[model samples]
Target: MTVTVQPSPRPRAARSSGIGRLLIAVYAVLALGAAGRSAVQIIERFDTAPLAFTLSAIAALVYFVATVALIAPGKAWSRVAWAAIGFEAVGVLIVGALSVAMPQLFPEATVWSFFGMGYLFIPLVLPWLGLWWLATVRRSERVAAAAEAA
Candidate 1:
């Protein structure tokens, strides 16, 4: 009797073609939204709700960083993309609850307020979308690599 062990599948390290571009666009929008809101919050009302503004600033930084990570073409970028999106998912959920349950605590709205109602729920949805986009990127990259290998 003969036994064979198949090698495990490899990790993906590149972006999809068209889908990658679309993901980049979505990330770009997220980055823009977060950055803009954070800027406003920090500049407009530093004394009113410092915590909320600080969260917004961090969220904005995360979104922009995630966008850059996903857009870059490499393995390190994939790792960064995963980290950023995961953090974003958690941030939205936590901030959403806080804003809803503790309205008084928040002097004004942040991006993740009311489950991202202000951004039309984009903040709530973008992380999931980003995961999907990254998956697509990985799959396409794998297929392309396989084709080349073949």
Candidate 2:
């Protein structure tokens, strides 16, 4: 006679829980809003504020990537989320500082201008929140994987 042991199943990542659902929803809305704003800015008067409009487009892309990454499964998506959220935070900080120091550089506003003042600073805050969520999810995954392996 022979006996075999099966490993325990892994626990779900934190990103798939209730708070994650809310984060996904917020990211989706931000993506949509930024896309629309950037599209209008680029199409209507690209020459007037090319840099700002370009930054807006970039911000929109970041938001979209972050939203998708948050909903996606696996460690790969977690990495993507980290990259996207990190870039967003850096971009917002740089743009916010530049816009203040050199107002002429931003004749118009990008999603990150004045730390997303137009959006009630959501753009500034979102990336930090996303990073926190990703870190939490990754930690939980590691613990779960170790538990399963044992």
Candidate 3:
């Protein structure tokens, strides 16, 4: 019997594109802004609002991690993105409420204070968008894989 030859599979496409690229860009910008703001706040006026300044630093770290995670490919990076985005959402909510309910606690606003009012509420809204994007990407990938199998 003649041997049947099989063609090699093509390389998988990159996951980060379109809205994914937009998300990464936003995260990168936010990361830079937060990091710079936190650095100045911590160095110059930490004593004025320790809680707020510390929160700013934390927000910066989260943003930085999220930006990197969103850009990187692999399930591990996706998990990191999930964790960072979720934590950012919670931080925004808690800090926003605290800043409003007890203004005394925050002599100065953190990046997340006022639900990220300073950043046009992007902090408040971005996480949900990111989560949705992640879910959509996962679903689409699954559908594609199923279709390929069939």
Which model scores highest in lDDT? 2
lDDT, model 1, position 136: 77
- Alpha carbon lDDT of residue 17, candidate 3? 68
> What TM-scores do the predictions have?
0.80, 0.91, 0.88
Show pairs that collide, candidate 1.
Answer: none
Tens digits of per-residue lDDT, candidate 3, 1-150, equal 999887644334333666988998899899999999999989998899999999988998999998888889998998898899899988899999999999899888899999999999999999999888888777776776776786
Q: Which stretches of candidate 2 lie over 4 Å from their true place?
A: 1-10
At residue 86, candidate 1 shows an lDDT of 91
Q: Arrange candidates by TM-score, highest first: which order?
A: 2, 3, 1
For model 2, name the residue pairs that clash.
none
Task: Provide C-alpha RMSD values for all models, in order.
Answer: 7.0, 2.7, 3.1
* Best prediction by TM-score: 2
Task: Provide the clashing-pair count of each candidate structure.
Answer: 0, 0, 0
RMSD of 3: 3.1
lDDT of each: 0.80, 0.90, 0.87
Clashes (candidate 2): 0
